[model samples]
Target: MLPKFPMSRQCPYHPPAGYAALKKEGPLARVRLYDGRTAWAVTGYAETRQLLVDPRLSSDRSRPDFPVLVPRMAAAKLVALVGMDPPEHDVQRRMLIPSFTVKRVNSLRPAIRRIVVERIEALLDGGRREADLVPEFALPVPSTVICELLGVPYGDHEFFEEQTRRMLMATSTADEAAAAGGALNRYFDELIETKLAEPGEGLLDELIVDRLGPGELTRLELASIAMFLLVAGHETTANMIGLSVLTLLEHPEQLARLRADERVAAGAVEELLRFLSVADELQRVAAADIEIGGQVIRAGDAVYLPNAAANRAPEVFPEPDTLDVGRGTRHHLAFGYGIHQCIGQNLARAELEIALYELAVRLPGLRLAEPVEQLGTKPGGSVQGILRLPVVW
Candidate 1:
């Protein structure tokens, strides 16, 4: 029997139990997806890296055979950089790359630090013995930063958060996801019009005055890019923040280590990113015939690259399941590989380092308010994260 795609994880920190056996089977194997579609699931680290940069593979979601994780995702149009193919993808990605470059992100470090510190202070000021870290701290830091950077009103965070949640839920119906996407598109449309009228000192305004004003990009495409940044910039990082804290609390020794030395904090972030592998699956399609792992991926064949499994591959990292903060995880596929890798990774690293560092220093007594098993996980989606993390200090 073909194993089902997105096999459920028995533990939040580990890949689905079936993944170990799957990796043992081979580098690649066919799996059945939600809509009764069969696709190739790549589990080997080497193969994942090879295909990630292969020109024969396409990230274009408009392809009929593109591996859609959910019916809702299938119904949605592909207007963002994440779903575009070369030439178009290159052009679009280049336009936004300047804002995410290391130099630019580093320049924002002071602001990000201020946001993290403010959020931590707010949590402390609540005067409560216990608080849900997800909302009080984890979500706010990145959300506020992204809003300021994009010139979007942070007051509308609740609305966009809800819409993004619906759009990404694997079980959401086509209509539900479409409605959520529509809401976000409309919001961006209005925001773009506002920016056009009176420029602000945000990334969106820069794009409008520079790129859009020069007719370098269409209004629709600009809005779509802004929407992508707003969603991707905050959602993944927020989830990572919450999940990272929980993981550290569970591993007290590592937590102590991180607390003891700030120098090792950067390495700890990479290790956690590797171990968690939050975005479990990266979807793609075969644009042309390609031979990999002694198998032919025919044109139009759907492909599912489960990065979580690849990150845990023994060949890449000895004792892959173990979380060692000192482990060299620079080559890990958590942010993915090749040209389509996360553009916001630099900013993500900075945010995580600052957040974790501040959490350690400010709340040295931090502990889970409830049992680890009692914590809820997001039901089904590309991103893997905790529903809520209650903690006490």
Candidate 2:
């Protein structure tokens, strides 16, 4: 049984400083998880890429030795997205991929642009010269987009937003995250029933009634997909928007360069991803005994491949710590490499490009409302997000 401790400390990847330590330790080191098991943490760029690409590394957490972020129950639900080994993961991912394709997501650009404009207008109208970019701008963009994509009614997102926030907040205890997960599952169960009754063009509608036909996904599977989109699609982009916004505001010179040339925004987004790297590590268990970096990972051993660390590795990126947006270093693995590379990469790119470009262009004279360290933050999750990035224009 796992020891009872705060979930905040149990997170295998927390402070970026850990990566510096791992660099000195030759790429891999042991760390404890919420389940109280010590597992190998991979930080080197080459090793991280190998671990993610290796067929021998299983994303399944069902193994007894799997060192998970939350408790067994919560981790099980969280891993539903590309978390399982081949066959099953492939099937589920295939069903979900088309909805997030560049073509489909691009169709929603009008809606996304409308959403961004409305939110910015509201923020401006509120008359607060300084506001938290997170709750006001960063959180709403992705939340609205994901809800719109999944066919979730805008009115119904209150519960989902709350539950997803709890689950994504790394500081939440295992029980807390699990409870949030359960609530989200229940919400999806009801939402799926609604989608079943009224088939629409969105992903949920097609998955249940149209694409899958009858009995393709049981009630549980339907609910699982709904919850998966809620968390997976919403939280990560929200954090990135906030981090990217803060990053640009902090470095005005780069922001000016990006504003001067729209062509540079794409490269800037990639560099920001490599620098901030909010998506952290992807965890897996060894399917069979495999050797990585001369260290043997026995079957059933848990592994964490920290993409954030690897993206900043000195070996792959020259001057890894500095944010050189125009370096044109697009080869970074901020998104996990190999088959499980994020299906929503294009959508994420579009959102980041739109958000960053619009802010730089419209919110002229934008500056930090407070000192960098003074910004409020919640810790312990896969993404390190600012709670309140106060800013002034």
Candidate 3:
């Protein structure tokens, strides 16, 4: 019997129960997708890493054969770097690399620290004994930071946030997703034109005055990149912040360890990332016939690399089920691997470290207001994360 693709997880902190059987079957196995299409699902640590970096694989979503995990994803266009293959991918990535360098990300540290403090203060000022951390703190820090970075007006965040939420939700219909995408594209079109006329002090302005003026990039291309940054920049890290707090609270010992010694905060972030590989699957299509681990992925075949399973592979992480804040998790695929790895990873790491550290210091008595199983999770999507994390201190 063929396994089903995009299996649902029994718990947010772990992969779907079916993943164990799939891993036991082998590194690569055939699975049926939601659309009744058969594709290869790579479930092993080594195979996932190998194929992610393999030139024979393609990230172009424009390909007719590319795997569609959800109905909405099928309507997606290949305008952003995540969907573009190299040469074009290389050129586009290089243009934004300077903004995310270690030094550049570090320069933003003061601002990120300030955001965290202000959010925490607001939560305290409310004087509420119990609150949902998602909207109260987790979502705001990253949203504000991305708004500042992109020169997007924070007052307009509600519009883009609603559109992006609709676009990412698995329950959203193809038409709904397309409508959301269209709204974002049109919004950016107007914003890009404004930036061109009166360049501001944000990244969009830099790209306009430097890259666009030089004719190195088209207005549409610049707009697409801005849209990509706006969505990808906040969504992933915001989810991480909420989930990380919940995970640490669940394991009081680990939380206490972090609170006691702030020095281990960095290591704690890596462990949290490995433990909760939020992106359940990475989609790719074979550009050419490729053979690995006694399986042949023919040219034009769809491939699904489930990093959640790979991160838990026992061969790489002994007793992978347990959460250890001091564990060496540098090799985890949480940020992906190879050329398509997350471009904003440095910025993400900084935000997480500061946010988690502040939470530990300010809310020493923090605990879950509801049972772990009762917490709300975003349903039927590639990104696995909590919709609301209620807590009290």
Pairs of residues clashing in candidate 1 = none
Checking candidate 2 for backbone clashes, the offending pairs are 170-380, 170-381
Superposed on all Cα atoms, model 3 deviates from the true structure by an RMSD in Å of 1.1
lDDT at 129, model 2:
74
Q: How big is the RMSD of model 1?
A: 1.1
Q: What value of lDDT does candidate 3 attain over all alpha carbons?
A: 0.88
Per-residue lDDT, model 1, residue 171, is 73
Better of 2 and 3 by lDDT: 3
Candidate 3 structure, TM-score to reference: 0.98
Q: Model 3: how far is 225 from its true place, Å?
A: 0.4
Per-residue lDDT tens digits of candidate 3, residues 29-105? Answer: 88988888889999999999999999999998788887788888866856599999989999999999999999999
Write down the TM-score of every candidate: 0.98, 0.91, 0.98
Displacement of residue 337 (Cα, Å) in model 2 is 1.7
